[model samples]
Target chain A: MTTDRAHSLKQLRRMLLVRRFEEKCAEVYQQQKIRGFLHLYIGEEAVAVGALAALRDDDAVVTTYREHGHALVRGISPDAVMAEMYGRATGCARGRGGSMHLFGAAQRFFGGYAIVGGGLPIAVGLALAEQMQATKRLVACFFGDGATEEGEYHESLNLASLWRLPVLFLCENNFYAMGTALARHAAVPDLCAIPRAHGIVSESVDGMDVVAVERAARAAADAIRETGKPRFLELQTYRFRAHSMYDADRYRDKAEIAEWKKRDPIELFVARLKAASVATDEDVAAIEREVSGEVERAALAADAAPLEPISDLERDVLAKVVP
Target chain B: MTRTTYREGIRTALRTALHDDPRVFLMGEDVGKYGGAYACSLGLLEDFGPERVRDTPLCESTFVGAGIGAALGGMRPIVEIMTVNFSLLALDQIVNNAATLRHMSAGQFAVPLVVRMATGAGRQLAAQHSHSLENWYAHVPGIKVLASGTVQDAHDFVLEALADPDPVIVFEHQYLYAMEGELELGPARASPWRASVRRAGADLSVITYGGSLPKALAAAEALEAEGIRAEVVDLRSLRPLDDETILASVRKTHRALIVDEGWRTGSLSGELATRIMEGAFYDLDGPIARVCSAEVPIPYAKHLEDEALPRVETIVARAKELVARRG
Candidate 1:
């Protein structure tokens, strides 16, 4: 509906929204309102914003614990997700899932699969169903590079290829897979090898560049749409923060963190947009203000949200009894 | 009147479900061209075509997890994991994903997944292939456990599982596949949700399920010859256990003898004994007793395997001993 410039601006705003929302989340987490493992998706915004921009809203998404940005970009209201993190009754998951287990069934945002590589098989299932139904929708399954250590990583890749299911396997290579670097964990740090080994068409993209990410995702999505097959993308990006709130920065070198920060996804995207005459400094400032307002309002609403009643403690164990 | 083997009972259910529902499909190792590992899904692939009656590449976890995923995505997926031993590989998917999805999503999503597997020991499959892990699945919340003990149940329970909105784990005892019985439909048969009294007696209640049902019934018959009439209760639905039927039978008989193929230590029989004790502590004529498999891996030798499992002789002897003892 919008021109390329307008679309580019929307993607930039989404990145800013993800950035600011998580920033507020980090702030809320300090107050202990958002308990549990708060995995802020502050740095790796482009990967979600750019990649999701290229896909249709009907397509399914199954991602890992670091999924706040994905959930936001995929149309889960920040207020609802924030309320979930706050353990509110009106949260998207009715306050049960917390931050790490956000679920949006209606949105086809299947989960916040906390287990490493656990989402892969679920993603394959979604794709399998879509393929069976002859739907053009593809599943964008996101996982960390550390997930390669799992047997399911190989199993899912093999199954997706064997069935030629419509799944865009997005491996957000954020360098560190929770304290252990991808190099330290994987024998062949080349993230694309396993998919290629499974005969999947694989490519790598600079996850820091929003336009580049959107372009690569569009191409891959198009290929899957036409071929009704699986594709893989190693979104080579970096998380500016620690894995979770509890993670001490003992694993990474300070210099390495700063080095990756030089290619900060948001900063790089802002510079790209400005250079291409898509936006001005004032426009960027306006988006920053708008994002800040949205995040602040979401945080306030989440703070005011009521905790779930104790009487409903054991709800949803089963949807309905067989009797 | 119709007759069917336990295997055919399951095949009929599969055929009926696939014929009726467009979203229903079956997938497992050798379910398609191989006609299932035990022939439970024989001729289904040919009837429904390969897309619906799918065969996997021996990757138990992915296929099971895929079923969980597909179930979440509006498809009724019945995933077969060859045996309970192989089902262990897919435990993460079953326990972590399927069981936790509804609770974790806080009632927003329901995983209408049906996972079927062959369980128990009899044909000398040895330790790796022979295990009764129904207690493991039944122990979890958000999942329904069904182990059909009769031909009607074996055929009908699959349809029941498909109708339910939550994940159901059906354990078709590999030993009972060839056992044949006449199908009894209509109001006489109870729903899959309740326990059925296979035989009614005024003396003591013999509670069992799956592979142990026939042995318990045979034991009850032998007791009848000795003038000690023992009631036989088949627990079709293991989870959300039909406590009313079991307790009523136990109260009427004033005695209960539990039989199960799982080991005595931390067994479903143990749970049943505790529940019976809790529910009917005062209405007992004798101390509650259980005849469980000996605490050892089922050996390949027929004699050793027979000794390890709950035989009719073991159940009869245990019931007689319990009947003789006074509370």
Candidate 2:
């Protein structure tokens, strides 16, 4: 149908932008430009692009440090993100927070927290605010399969389910948590089943397929907004890059990587759009060119950005103290 | 003026906060159905219902993180760790997330959270549960630390902490929980932000707080027998320290004696001594004397535990030595 073609084309563009953005980050990381733990969201573009499409602009998003893709898909400009990665004042957090911590107040994107499972409770808390204030906004919390083992994840889920907070927990199960496979860390290989144990309604979708991810996200978001009950989505995905700049790639095999690479989300979505005649090769090339230029501009802006002076260190510690 | 016990004063503050604001709620282990481990939250469950006075599981990190999350979500959450020793389990959440969120977010988020727990020794509950670690928290950048040594502050500071937009830790002394006093039943009135001069004198300044306050006060009184005047100051707030009060007292006395419950090495006394040296180095008549607990884990035996913490006798001797010495 026409609707399917339109959706696939849109997803193709979004996924291309994310994939290109992360690839650019990897290239720059090799040049000794951006430092610290830079976790690339290269192959997991569908998880962010597809799921982000289902939610409204006002919905809050809390994600892990591998969140450049999420921040970009959530409408934070790639230039600001790249500049932030460069630790520039022009970036999202004014260069105070780098890759592991990207903030976008305008878009209601809470941040990219570095600590595994740290953002779960924060996301739940944001949903709790919406619930208590009678707001219709839903909070979409994104984390990796590694965060599932953290106690904060379980506690936040239990509290969210118990209180019936309007929250959608989107887990990007890339099958690896910082080079350690999910099978090695988690007792339950099926991450979706873990949320169900906390009485949360859950669904596991093929994260490599943008259409499936979008479909599940749409249903989950609608249910949460309507009933004020939490829903969980486990998107089965993979990471093409190492966990960080320091990874030796010893944890996983090349055959496994090749198998997942064969089903690359960006290429598959572009192919689907082409098959339906909704997008030509030229259109795909144009989107990629646009995304590449934007990423480049962001990096340029960041490189020129100034670092914060040491004198203002004591500022913003407390909002207001009633002395 | 209405008279009340230390426990009653804390209860009154919690009751007033809950009654005044719908967003303020208390969450901790044994704080609800069990009526709190210290009985400071006694009858609150019956008054405010189980929703506001939540009883959390023994999972300190998870619940503390939940409290931080709840605070982030617009609720003023009061997380109570039963003791200072148990709070170590939740240190990751307290130090990493709760303390750093505001700075990391560039002032976008305000953690209006209050974490209250019992601290210090003398109850024979030694080693694991009897240590005082407020100094460790005070050393952190973002958090405000308060040690309630008196009945009035134990009752009033909780209200002040809830009103503060940053995270605050209120350490209630375990030994002083039962010490009763007449409390004025009017609006809460105590400076939660500054130290108070409990017993003003001229010769030497006895700087202390929490479990060591009573000992310092007693030592000051005992020093009066030797014709020496020792000013006693209750360091109510430790973090945004009442630097002016301490400096003024030290400037006037020209001598300082620090009484602390924590051990000697890298103690809060060392920090205060550095501050005094930096602020009023020329005013000192002699090197600062520090009366701190022996550098050993508090033993379970009553006598050994008593000997482990800073005692009135040790404080008196330290004061005498400082007064007798010439710079």
Candidate 3:
């Protein structure tokens, strides 16, 4: 709602940060720094940043493995996230979770769960907790279009709807479940119908436009809070990078990637900001510079972080019981 | 001492947990209106109301995952997965989420969740309805596997397991639910982590748990007729096995025989045998032996089912052979 110059710039800076951070990760990944299933949120930045901006800090967030953008936008620092991927003692998860699993309980960001549709039920439970406590705090669960193919996804939707819990089922439909395209996997390629079939209030948004994403997400979140029911949003987006670092990318065409890259969320947002006279060319340049500097420092700090000793390997298998 | 059936003991535990903890809730198929598939939660719905006693649709994976989520969200959730056979549908949630959440999240999130399910083979419930797969859960690192065979354990382990800060799997043996026993009604006697010496002897250590505990005890009793004093050790908690008590029993008895209702191949009995070999091999008078179920799908026929599962006859025979060996 507060889409003034300052707030608009903040969102722009956040998107820029997510973009720059992943770009740096992609760079360092080639240098053999970050390892293991790096599913970059390179193009889907608008979905995480825009949707996260629509909710309160206390509202929970449960997202997928491809959640660097979501975690960064939801308030985890680049250093902590980077250090986690670096497997450092000072990391957000104490170096336990790598790129696929980022956790910050203090922020109420439940985690970046790796399993597809695995986080959906968790998000429903978080909302169930909030509902039982009468906290009015909603949970925004982000998953890909691939998750809708999972049974947990359908069950979660039904439970959330049946109980009328506050949850926003944000599906980043980037047209691919790793390598298989939507049509190849889903019998009904249209995702909105599935949630609508479950009697959930559903909407579709242009995920490339940050303004559109934020607007749709805000309305969805507001409705959930008021009705205490789940809402589904199908954000039509595309991933600018491979699914993971190891992906051969033989499934998608080169022309398709080029077309999607042309409508990159960060660049599109900057263009809209300039057109609306919300931010100047100089303001955009300053934001880019600031994000780049922060990313550089975070990468350096993470590289210097220490790996936990083998003695502490068994520390978290179970919580220590008090005698 | 309170004389109650194992079913009543479980019911009491559930009743007490729901009454005491405001955050605790039980959800599973037929748990509410139908009073649970096993009737362990016979009148919980009427007592606690709908919010606390939830009867879920048969979406095991989602409900189990929801339990893990609710636990992570700071609510104590107890999810019932009807039977171990049906639990396979939610294996992803149990193995991947509940068990892996704590360690993978670097302890930032502890899944203080309890999952209860009926387990083991008996009755006329054929192949699909009967099986003992606690070994699969015990194989995981972050979970505590509890097998409640007696009335006291049925009443106690559920209460104690809830106090644990990690995921605990409670397997209530289907056959043992009707067995009535005496419960020392007071505070829980001890931590559920250690094995309990049900009947002590100096000849053979007959190790077992869950439905097989009774069979092993009966076998020990029958073995006593022939002057073979066999000790019975009930492994209350299967995952964090009480190796010290097991070793101590084997050290004292100088012989060991494991009776388990599960299949012999890749069984909890095998793990126990390995642990005994590692800890008290020198003290053993002969090769460690185990009397486990026949490696076949459980049959509904009374005669076949009885022969397939570990029996007191098999246990006594295995013990006599082990004790007779001169090695």
Candidate 4:
């Protein structure tokens, strides 16, 4: 197999893994194994897998609550991610942060910030640290189209632009914030314009195309590294699942969902690989089976993981006092 | 020993922090060009340059959240909010990110951020500018809240808060900027977490912090003149509550009066009173009392503002009432 074939195969594997992992999460959520606002990255897998593939090992990533894909693609262990969802002691965050707050310092995956636009400034600050330290490490900040309405989003963009911080602002434009659609929430629905207004380089990409997202992310990341200035990418994606377990998704039309599903990222990528002769039908089926097995193993490991001791509930509130 | 104003003490601490540590930087609105809102950071921008002393746009949540991120990214960021009221614009970052990040991340990260803000109602700054909302921050668990009342504290607490591993919020009393006192220059021996007994007496105990500390001391002086020796316990640290010192003072005095500039309902003073009732209830010869701000918005007028906040007269009166009820 060629190098391009290998990369395409890896990307397919990651996207498949995220899809199967989230599907398992939804199934378990129905069985009451994992609880509390479970926001799945069902249709938005390409945005996380493709965009995160462009980052350097030293670079940072700050993402929103719908971040299982981001965590998985950022190289956090599947067992740890599943254990966090299970609220187990062996989880990445030791079961403290649930589905909405996955964090891993070693991976430089800052957090799965639950607040709409809360992670933007944190990303800017991380980039600001890199700039101040005179390092080449960049930070990738991910948010939804809904975050554009937040003042922090505007403030973060202005600061990132003004300071010339090496930041890649990845706007996962999934069209809705919870139940409120972008048309209803934002005064200007064009999110790319908002970043461009802040004097930052901005572009919109087909988020459903994994190759397109990866190309855009790499270009944006390169631009930020070369110029030490922030760049923004509005990945036009969509969430196929309900906003959370509680959401009935009354706001969106079934027709619109069906229309978006026709452009399903994984199916599109699989077809592209097949047409390009990069992967065969057997190859795709094998990748799907492998990912399904991996996800099942993760779920089993998470279920077997022990609960964090209740006596340590007050631990880690502050840094341990060194004697 | 040098006599310095609270404003100068704060400036010295900031300057010292910047000079001593390479990782320390200041970022806030008007902190660079306009000095500080209360001139607490005057002349440091010219000395340290713009990078260390940053002047940010009028966006509180972003800058404060940036401070948290900077702290997480291995820099000590001292973010100054013009006043307690303006700090509310950044409350989400303060409460959600700064305060809860360490715990939520399960100790993977600790935000060593120092947030400074002017607090309390005096100088007639009106409701928007003058608010004693330290209690709101003190109610939080992860972050440590400090109230600097004396010139010595204003000089020392900033340095100590910067050294703290967790996020620390230092509430500087707005009215205390020009307050002059003898500050023994050098390393401070007092810990930021411990409550100090500024004036030791046995008749009654006046527990207070921040802008109300001076008023509590003045009340103690007045009680002294009335042959009632009142002990004054300055609660420098609000979050941890220094329950041992408070209980010790209450046990000695046998009477307690909590003076807080915040409203009576859900105030730090109420927390202090409850602690006393829990630990020193049998030791108390009389019921615990508190002199808190009136439950209305602090008015603009000088008289009304003075009447709304806890004052010397009210503290004196409350102290006397508590002491008289003793046996």
C-alpha lDDT of residue B54 in model 3:
93
Error of 3 at B48 (Å): 0.9
For model 2, residues B61-163, the per-residue Cα lDDT tens digits are 7678778877877789888999999999888888888888887777777788999999998999978999988889999988999998888888778888988
Q: TM-score of chain B, per candidate?
A: 0.98, 0.98, 0.98, 0.98
Using lDDT as the measure, the top candidate is 4
As a whole number from 0 to 100, the lDDT of residue A170 in candidate 2 is 93
Chain A of candidate 2 gets a TM-score of 0.95
Candidate 3 chain A, poorest ten consecutive residues by summed lDDT: A314-323
The lDDT of model 2 is 0.86
DockQ, all candidates in order: 0.79, 0.54, 0.67, 0.68
lDDT, candidate 1, equals 0.90
Q: iRMSD per model?
A: 1.0, 2.2, 1.8, 2.0
Output the lDDT of residue A47, model 1.
95
Badly placed stretches (over 4 Å) of model 2 are A1-7, A321-323, B185-190
Instruction: Write candidate 2's Cα lDDT for A239-314 as tens digits.
Output: 9988888888898999999999999988887777777788889988888888788878777777777876777676
TM-score for each candidate, following the candidate numbering? 0.98, 0.94, 0.99, 0.98
Docking quality tier of candidate 3?
medium
Residue-level lDDT of model 1, residues A92-205, one tens digit each, is 998889888988877888998988888899999999999989999999999989898799999999999999999999999988878888778999999899899999999999
Docking class for candidate 1 = medium
Rank candidates, TM-score, best first. 3, 4, 1, 2
Q: Could you arrange the candidates by DockQ from highest to lowest?
A: 1, 4, 3, 2
Give the residue spans of candidate 3 off by over 4 A: A1-3, A321-323
